[model samples]
Target: MRAPCERSERHRSVARRRWISRASWACLMAACLGGAAPPFVSSVSFAQQPGARQAPPPAVVVEKIEVQQVSNPAQFTGRVEAIEAVDIRARVTGFLHSVDFKDGQAVKAGDTLFEIEPDQLNALVASARAQVARADATRISAERSLARNRDLLARRTVSQATVDEVQAAFDVASADVQVAQAALDTAELNLSYAHITAPISGSIGRATFTTGNLVGPDSGSLARIVSLDTVRVAFAVTEGLLVTIRQQQASGGGLDPNTLKLSLRLANGTDYGTPGRIEFIENEIDPQTGTVAARAVFPNPRHILLPGQFVTLYVQEKDAPSLPVVPQTAVLQDREGRFVYLLGKDNIVSQQRIHTGARVGNGWAVTKGLDGGEQVVVEGIQRLAQGMTVQPSQGQPVGGGT
Candidate 1:
């Protein structure tokens, strides 16, 4: 009975130990419920399914803004002309006469250009002179007869009627002499008109009337002569341009007549060596073309710039300080206005509005906005936006606008 009792005691003790062990296990599990995920599972799971890394925005090349001094030149187109030009014509009527000047020859004022046969003219002059001699002899005879009759009447040897008749004869002879003198003058004038002379000193054009071609007062133009030593160029300018010109002139910006420099480029691109000055400005504007005619005078010693030749003109305005310039690519235009992309201190791009002037070598002149040393975005401008970041690269110089 003692042994059985001891066995029952041992079983109870084991049962108690089992119950404590189960209670401790439950407490540990409850504590673990308040804790984070296990280290092994958390770390391993994250390593197997990590999220993708985002790519950085593409870097865009940019440029630095700068100020530069440049020349301001205005270009225009013009035409060449002759200083003076006139059509040659005969002043007297006659049979086909001799042309004294060769085609395209240079002639001086009063130079004989053509001549009519003088035989008929010379005969008229001789006949007029003979008439004058005969009239003078008749007048002398009438005067002697009138004196004899007067003496006879005074001596009562002749009647009063005879004396009156002698006086009338003398008067008629005097009238005849006066008419002969007038005829002689007319004949001399006709002789002079037979010779056609140049009215001006200039280059003569191709002769329209040949040596045997009839030339006279009614024969019309024989040829033309154009004076080219000093030539004039006529150009048309718009009303707006005229206003600008007037303002420039009023501002004391006009070139002196002696200092006015002008150059020409022909349609074929040949340069005219001679220089010129502005001569005249037309008062009226052409209603159809909406422009006024302006004239320029050029030194044409070589006569290379012929009249009526089309050409391009260049006029130099007042010299000014160099202007700020930028590449054309940097400039952008929209409904708002013209602007450029510039890199900021944060290495980001920002749009800046600007005023532009005439084109410089390969770029445009910045009239306003933007100081020196700012990075300007030239390339990749299309990809840039306001406040966008960019990578900048030094670019080629913006030379004169092409």
Candidate 2:
């Protein structure tokens, strides 16, 4: 056996020779198999080199520009109201005698609602009539005395002062009759007021004062009545839009009070079929809210629109102007700002920042950044980098129904 150092050198030399022989065999096999040997050799090579990484492409959908009709109707929140609403209050102070109408019942103008006890008024009227009868008897006696005095004055049997006294007595009796007649009229008026009557045709609300309850002229409202044959919807127009409204009115290009068309949607999302016209707009804008009050009248024949009901108002006008719009999916947000991917002629995606306005259906009105004819990537933006080349397909959006 050799020394220890000599033994180590002999083992290294044998290992090198073995590696050389294995490499030569591999080279010969690769030459024979040519292209077929690469996969197998690559597998062997991959085993030696570890930690290789693979990246995936982003998946998305897209859309193109198409011409369409766009409407920019003024939008506002409003409330349904009766054309006229009045609170029923007692005209004279007295105990309520009887209630004539049921709660929530439809009423007509001059319909009796509540009957107050008119016993005192009736007594007063009867007393006034008696006084009138007494005055009539006294006047007859004075008239007979006056005629005798006039005859004696004509015959020079009495002085002028005596005739004047008799005439004055007759005049006093006639004046008393007029006074009593006025008193009777007052009593009659009071009795009529005792019967609470509706001032306007409407539907009566729950009674605040019932039978035997004391009510007075100065008392707060006893009940409420709202006329629903025609209803008004009150809404506010923002100060920003006020200028546009005025401009439209001044141009005489859009609907005026007579020609304007209006519609309403109920709280439950049902549309009021009868279209309305703008009745009036307030002269001044509200200083507190910076909005102008506008009223539109709708025919409520069936009394469907009730007072105090919340409603959404849609004031329809002629077509506005056309605006550029893109699918909502195309819009993307990041820390920088809102953006979308634009596909170039080479099927590459480029980042584009956009300024948007009102949303029309499922698309946004692009005010800035994108123009007509620019293809925006509605889908597949996530799969792309700023400069990465991508395969683009005209992605059809799922649903965009009106």
Candidate 3:
């Protein structure tokens, strides 16, 4: 190699000649194109470089906005309740002789739940019977005495006052007999109560009092039974929602609450397949809560729903407004709020700000921003930027409704 400075000078001279040639070529190209540089010359300077490759636009999957019929369901936390709930309490005082049913047992109306030992109750019944028999014996004797006394008076052998006195004695005995029979009837009724039976078909809870435990009417409750074949769900609605249920429509006083459709999501998040109908709405809102009570009846043949179970209740109105819907994948969110990339004319994508409402099936109900006919990018959004051009293809989102 020659001296270092001379070698560097020769290299600089060659680079300057190349630079001048490139500048002259760029000027000639600019002149040929109009009097200004090409559009990409400033922002994408490499486009003017010789042999540079152009990139293809990114591909994106898009879904068209669809008009979806929705029910606009109102959601609230609810509780599972039996239409008929009864606490099992012994009507007559006695020792619990036998627990007739197992804990958590399914029972029908008139099913024997427990048997209270009827030692004292039976004694009372026997005593009542004895008193009634004695009253009958006394009444018979008094009537015979009165008849003989009246016969003596008819023969003029006795005074009328004596016969009248005997008659009064007979009346007193008859009254005693009637009182005794009434007591016996009450005793029999009490005996029947000793055999505690379910008043309604339902699932029975655990037995509170076991064998040898003295239970009576005053005893809190021996157990509880709740009806299962047809259950009810109780939920509270806000003042606004209460109005919606009672007066959703202007005419006809409002939508009939009986016509409102109801459904439930259990605590475990599984949906109860059976639908329910609104059965009751309170006459007034609760003064303390400002919420009104409402109930829906559901057919629970399987007894899967239990009383006091917390659930998520959904009440749907039939005359819901049609809404613009889009697949969830098309939505993008940042600090500025939610937006979707709209596939506009000539494959250009622009950001569309949207006000989203409730989710409808697998998609979102678009409350605002988009009409029902526009297309939006649902996939390949990672590489997207504002005003970008993309290769758009249709995305698949199937059937709707829940």
For all candidates in order, the CA lDDT equals 0.80, 0.81, 0.87
Q: What is the C-alpha RMSD of each candidate to the true structure, in Å?
A: 11.8, 7.1, 8.9
Model 1, residue 153: distance off in Å is 13
Question: How well does candidate 3 match the true structure, expressed as C-alpha RMSD?
Answer: 8.9
TM-score against native, each model: 0.62, 0.68, 0.71
Candidate 2's C-alpha runs over 4 A off are 1-69, 247-255, 318-359, 364-402
Per-residue accuracy of model 3 over 268-382 as CA lDDT, tens digit each: 8899999988888788889899999988889999989988889999888756778888888888899999999999889999998999987888788888898888888889987
The CA lDDT at 305 in model 2 is 89
Off by over 4 Å in 3: 1-60, 244-253, 318-324, 327-390, 396-402
Question: Order of candidates by lDDT, top first?
Answer: 3, 2, 1
* Tens-digit lDDT string for candidate 2 (286-338): 99999999888889999888888888887655454455677887888889888
- On lDDT, the stronger of 1 and 3 is 3
- The lDDT, on a scale of 0 to 1, for candidate 2 is 0.81
- Where is model 1 more than 4 Å wrong at Cα? 1-79, 131-186, 239-263, 285-290, 313-321, 333-353, 369-377, 382-396, 399-402
Model 2 Cα shift for residue 173 (angstroms): 2.2
What does candidate 1 score on TM? Answer: 0.62
For residues 86-140, could you state the per-residue lDDT of candidate 1 as single tens digits?
Answer: 8877766666578878888989999988787777888999999999999999999
